[model samples]
Target: MTGRNSGATRRTPAENAQLALLLEVAGTPKPGNVDRRRDLEDLRFEHFLAGTVGAGKGLRRAEHGARVGIAFERAVAGMSRQSGGNTQFGCLLLLVPLVSAAARGDLTPDGLDRVVADTTVEDAVSFYRAFEHVDVAVRDPPAEMDDLDVRRGEAAAPTLRERGLTLSDVLALSTGDAAGGGMEEEARGETDGEPGAETEAGTRGIPDWNAVDWTTGFERPFAVAASIRDDTGPIGDRTARAFLEVLADRPDTLVATSHGPAVARDVSERAADVRGDLEAADALADALVEEGINPGTTADTVAAGLFVALERGLSV
Candidate 1:
């Protein structure tokens, strides 16, 4: 543990040395040097505590909710990066401290609430921007030129290489379901006697009654939901709401399908499954990248999928 700084007016010599040490450790190239990362995290944790106390005084003088919320959100993001390893598991560790601090009124709960409410399409982009170095991107699997019916499981999995994303390009994919519209309601006849206008008692019902298209309406959001689920597992209700709110500016609008209700239910369930798959992939990538694995073709596929999903929806 580093020495504590008790003096209000000046930094101790030990504190100055610790700050320098943190910077140097973060710049190292060794793979999974968690000890070095941990040092930097510890410093940030100290800053989080200090900021919580300091922000309370500032909040009293602030009036704009938006401004306050942005500051609060940034503070929380910083606190999250600190406190330990920056993996998803490490993030959970900070939740308890965050809740306790917020409960004491040291950190403004309203500020966080406002931030959560403000998850607009713009916010989604902003979220990516804030964490650019973390390698978060949209996921979209590509269409197999050789095999059109290929699923992700059959495709070779790839992990991140360098500091950039190359596979599962979410931006280029279409999100509509694979099925065409259901139902065959007749057009109102101009001629009353045109082709059996008056049907017998045993008339044929809708031919495609059971034909539900996977590539139809609600695809984009569902795909987005799927990717998020894959990457992070099924988030809580509040988290899901926050995510949807952030994507409010997405251009795709869904028309209710024949099985719209059923689709909605399935989409939610599928999102969770996707999330689990994604987290496992991320963890695998982290380990492989640490071990100097050559992603090669796998990297390209992941990047392609990510681009396709984000831009075109899940149709790819």
Candidate 2:
């Protein structure tokens, strides 16, 4: 029951989603992320491409009305087929629901909101299953919920079922925004914070801000999509710029996790300084690469954003 959005492009929603993955990696000068010319010690550009190719199966499943959790897990499984490991885990987290919403004939924020909210405990179980296939760089879960640690993978399933937590519930709990406005703070992520400290880690394990995107009405990616749509010049350049915008808006949780929050905030400040200066941006790109500071979460959001922009008719 897959459906396409009525628009100028003839490609299926699945094709557009895959193209977004390609476009995000192809964009040059994306500081701290694997791109046309950059590769982390563990991840290469080709790995991303291969991951994209494998991701199609999962994307198609989502388009055809697969449960959000099931589609995301399958997509993660397919994406893990490559040597790059978990190249697009966060991207798929955002894209699976977006593609499902589009196929269901409502691609707006409200529509996406409902899709995640409607997830079942089975979906949570499937999401945990995704972790078993790939080595995503996730922190350990909170202590009280050690039984639900994603690292426990399939072993966490029975606990999830007993708790009656849906995939959305799991994500919201992971972000610790279920009971506060921290979810909203993560949605914008550009506000002031300590330059030498990690942002107050509301919760430890699971993915961070992108998981927040799951619970925050998917605001950040859509906003980044708007930035992409309003920009000019080559699509690669547009993507590069949008990547920076996301970095500027928030200290990337991935960078924060591996490098510490202070470094992540410093990176965000650097991104803000890039503003209209591509030369400065390129310089920062070089520095980030040299320092091994990978703002992968920002890249994932940008990929999801690119998908949103393309689906809404941003052209090639």
Question: Highest TM-score: which candidate?
Answer: 2
Instruction: Report the number of backbone clashes for model 1.
Output: 55
Per-residue alpha-carbon lDDT of candidate 1 for residues 23-129, written as tens digits (9 for 90 to 100) = 22222121112222222212323432332333332222221233322332343344234333122111111122222223233322342233233334332232223
Evaluate model 2: give its lDDT: 0.77
Which regions in candidate 2 have their CA more than 4 angstroms from the true location? 1-8, 177-207
TM-score of each: 0.20, 0.89
Cα lDDT tens digits for candidate 2, 136-248:
55554446667877767789888988889888888887686232112111111112232233344522422378777887778988899889989999999999989888889
Q: Top lDDT: which candidate number?
A: 2
For candidate 2, give the lDDT of residue 3. 34
